[model samples]
Target chain A: MNAIEINNLVKIYKTGTRAVKGVNLTVAKGDFFALLGANGAGKTTIISILIGLVNKTSGSVKIFNYDIDRQFDQAKRIMGVVPQEFNFHMFEKVQDIVATQAGFYGIDRVTALTNSEEVLKKVGLWEKRSSIARTLSGGLKRRLMIARALVHKPEILILDEPTAGVDVQLRFGMWDYLRELNAGGVTILLTTHYLEEVQQMCRHAAILKEGEIVRLDSVKNLNKLIQQETYVITVRNMQPLDGIQSYAPVVIDEHTLEVNLNRDEQLNDLLIKLIQNGFAVTDVHPKEHRLERLFLSLL
Target chain B: MNSQWIAFQTLVRKEVARILRIWTQTLLPPLVTQTLYFIIFGKFIGSQVGPIHGISYMSFLVPGLVMMAVINSAYSNVVSSFFGAKFQRNIEEMLVAPMHEWVIVAGYICTGIMRGIVVGILVFLVSCFFTHPAIDHIGIVIMFIILTAAVFSLAGLINGIFAKNFDEVAMFQNFILVPLIYLGGIFYSILKLPVFWQNVSKLNPLLYMVNGFRFGFFGFCDVSVIFSAGLLIFLTLVLWQVNIWLLKNGIGIKN
Candidate 1:
């Protein structure tokens, strides 16, 4: 069964604005799905509709085969949502937030407490469990949200911009934990502006533009649409390669040389040319992320 | 069903804890204000006004003051707390959860009722320092107190659901609730009013609640116990249904 399924979903604001216009999408069970969109592209409206925070104008939404309109409680029981905004009581203690969320799922106090501790420890917030949420930093708050979402042991985790303001270290740590959760058979649906994270984490992706899915495919298939890959080669020392126009290399500062090569171009040929030109290459890496190129192309 | 109970308890606990944590704002102000009313209205002013209905002026004022505190606390508790949740957007957490709409409304109203009763007890205790209020019908007093709290709490929930700002909440308390309570005959019996004013006082729903509560304390009221009890019950049922409808429709919570 699909973890989530939306058929012709539409949302029209009272102000006569059509936020979402008949969007149809699906995420399979145990799959890591990415819903990519720019700001005001109706991503949040979709999430809100599924979670009962926003009323849908038209369409059907089913979670784990339960209709959202008719079986909301059953649908919600198996799903956890991390909304884009921080929607927690700021004055509440860290431990209380997670446990209260578990209680909302009808979990008993003993189980809620146990789950809270487990999730807090996993998020590296056990030491600050008794502290008020307002005292935590932004990254810690994001982690707290993740911990709360996980406390109920939901089968489907829907994260909307989960790491929007998190630092690089915390972002990677969260990514690792999410990957571990997915590996453990949790279906994950994520929306994020960072295309690199989508490339690394999601197997299937759908790109929404102006309330419509303009592109949908596997990450590998999306990457196949890229006609060329840009490579940034780091040289051993600072050197001026101003006359190297044949490769159209952009000499960035002293040690970096960026070159764009088509799909048919050979890496060895570029390396041999650089060697013959008396330039020492220390390392070479793709400059543009695979998902980033595909994302731009679709937009 | 068990889960629904658990969720309800959690919401109630959170609401009560928040109010208790800010006791100076929630508990202290009402107690202090009621004490002043006891001193100024019952002691100093009552000495000049003398007795009405064959009871001391101080005793006549106790039940009304207690009910006044009950009304204020119950109304403010729900309005501020619910609006605080909306302003902070924390209400979305409950909205996105699996709990029933009735559970959410009941949890908030339960908190309001709890605060109302607590404040009523405190005000009554303050009144005790000045006068011994006769308990003509303890059961009637308890019933009216609970019903008054429920009615105002439901009204507050409706106001909170519609309020878009803190100013709107204050407007509800000031422009609507305060005038209704004052004109409800908390200070003087409606019998003291001129004929036309007496009829006008009857239009204020709060008059029935206060008179019903006074009947419980002194066994005397401008209105019959049956009329007061009937009106209170009818209003409670209507307000409850209105609150439930608001929650289901997501009037002020959802876009």
Candidate 2:
């Protein structure tokens, strides 16, 4: 069964704004899926509908085969949601915040405490268990939300920009933790502005534009849709680029060069030509993230 | 236990913990306020007035003061706590949970009742320092306090549902609740009012609550004790149903 399935979802606000316009989507069980969209593209609205925060105007949503309209209790029991905004009591202690979330799922106090401890420690917040949530740094607060969502041990984890304000180091750590969870068979659904994260962690992705799905495919398949890519190459020794002018090479500095590879061209061919010209290339990387380039082009 | 029961218990526990955690705000104010009422109204004011219904004026004021505390505590507890949750958006934590709407309603109402009873007891204790009022019917005392608290708690939940800001939450208490409680015969007997005002005072639901509670202490009242009890029970049921309907409809909590 799919972890999440939506058919013709529609949400028209009372203010006469059509936020979501008949969006259809599905996330397979145990798959890491990314839902990418810009602000006002209805990503949060769709999520809110799934979690019962917003009443849908029309459509069907099923979580693990439990229809959200009819079997919402059963659906909610197996799903954990990390919303885009921080929605916890700031006055609460970190431990209590997580444990209280477990309690809301009907977990006993002893079991909730145990789960809280495990999830908090995993999120690097065990040491701050007694600190008031407002006292935590922004990154720690994000981790605290993650811990609270996980304390119930949900089978499906839905994270909406879970690493938005996190530093690079903490974001990478969170990615590793999320990868571990995915490997452990928890179906993961993510929405984020970080296209690099989509390329690194998501197996499948869908891009939403103005409340409609514009593209949906595997990450690798999506990357292939980009017909050309630009790379920044750092050379060990400066040399004349007359041999590589076919690739439109631009000299950035004494050691750096910018080059573009089209659909029929290969980086190996360009590197071989540069070497034959005594360019002595030492480092090479894409100028922009592959998925980011694809996303921009699609939008 | 069932999941609904567990969820209810958790919500109640969290609410109760919050009340105790902020005892200075939740539990202490009523005690201090009632103490001032006892000293000023019971001692200084009652000294100038003679007994009514063959009971001392101070004794006559005790039950009414206790009922007033119960009403205010129950109403404010749910209004402030629920509105605070809505304001901070943490109410979504429960909204997205697997529990039924009634579970959430019961959890909040139960905690409100608990605070009401606790504050009622404290005010009663403070009253004891000024006067030694006899309990004519302990059963009626317990029944009336709980019933009145339930009614107001349900009303408070409705207020919390419709309230958009802190000012709205306080508006009901300041403009509606205070006038009703004062006119409910807490300070004097409605029997002394002129015929038209006596009928008007009877229209106030709080009068029945205060008189019902007072009947428990003195075994005397301007209205039938059974009638007052029945009115309170009826109000409780009606308010309970209203609260359940509001929650199920997601009247103000959901988009």
Candidate 3:
């Protein structure tokens, strides 16, 4: 069963601002699902709805076969959220912060404390457990958020912009930790601006534009959409176009030339043709489609 | 009494800790500021006016100071906490939680009340520095202080919900609260006012809180404290409903 199911979810603000038009998505259990979009895109809104924060205007949200409306408690039980913003008590200690989140899941104080310690260690913040939440650095604060979210051991974890301002090293560290958790059977719903992170971490992805789900597919399938592989060649000279008949039509701009190739094109043949034409190929590199370019093209 | 109550309690604890963690700012500053009002106005100004009802001028001024502490701290706690949540964009955590909307409002409100009462009690204790403290009815005094804290806290939460920037909270504090607290007959009895001004003072809802609290100390009041308590309670329920509606509708949280 899918860990979380959202169908045509819509949210319209009171001031009549339609934040999320309608989004439909399904995240299979234990799958790492990436929800990708720009700043004003409906990623946060959709995440908020799944976590039961923002009330949906229309549409059904189901978690574990329990509808959010009829079985809100059941749905809430299995969902853990790491909000994009700092949500911990600023004056609270790291341990207390994680413990409080556990308490929200009906965990007793003793177990919550034990769980907090274990999760804090998992995030490498165990040494800073006694430190106040506001006193920690930005990256540490984000890690603390992650630890707190996992304290309850929820079946599904939702992270909204989990790595927004963290340093590169810390970002990868978080991704590693999240991947480990996913391997342990925890479903993860990640919303992030860094497309590379999605490509590296998530196997399933949903692209949202202006509150609508423009595309949702397996990471492999999405990558397959750009069927023609790309290659950029910086030749010594741009001879007459007829000299290179083997290569597909090339787009030329300044010193660089880019060509689109069919999936079955032989790389060796193309390279040999360029070499024999009296033009030295300074650089010949195959380029895979980037999520950013695909995203821009969709927009 | 598990998740909902526990979450509410955790939020309240966070709120209280935020204020008490920095007692110099939360509890002490307001106490010191209220003392200046007592020294400058009650001691110096009242010596010339003489006692109002066998009560020393400083004694009469204590209730007003305590009420001021309650109202100011209560309002500031909710206004600042809610606005801080908004400013930091942290309210999304609670907004996205499985917990219901009212729990969030109540949690913030309780924190406001705790801060207000703590500051109010501190001011009440500090009043002893100037004059002998008197409590004609201990129960009434406790009830008055608690009810005052709850009412003002709810009002402050409402303000926090509607506030967009730091200035909006300040606008309510500067324009609405200051005038209301002053005209509420904090310094003098409402009956002492000229007939026209007495009716005008009656229009300020804060007058009931101040007068009701004063009656708690002296057992003497111009307005009915029961009516005041009931009215304040009604306003609190109304604000609570409104706050929950605002949250559920994503009035400010969305975007």
For candidate 3, lDDT tens digit of each residue in B1-255?
Answer: 577887787677667767867878778889789989988987888788767666777888888889999999988888888988887776755654566777888888888888888888888888888888788988878877877788888888878888899999899899989988988888888777789988888888888888888888888877998998888788777877888888766676664
lDDT of each: 0.92, 0.92, 0.82
lDDT: the better of candidates 1 and 3: 1
Query: lDDT ranking from best to worst?
Result: 2, 1, 3
Stretches of candidate 2 exceeding 4 Å from the true structure: A236-238
Candidate 2 residue-wise lDDT, B43-137, digit = tens: 99889999999999999999999999999999999999999999988998998889798898899899999999999999988888888979999
Better of 2 and 3 by TM-score: 2
TM-score of 1: 0.97
- Across residues A155-252, which tens digit of lDDT does each residue of candidate 3 receive? 99999999999999999899899999999999999999888888899999999888888889988778767646778888877766576765654657
> By descending DockQ, how would the candidates be arranged?
2, 1, 3
Candidate 2 displacement at residue A140 in angstroms: 1.8
DockQ for candidate 3, C-alpha atoms: 0.36
Question: Interface root mean square deviation of every model, in Å?
Answer: 1.2, 0.7, 2.8
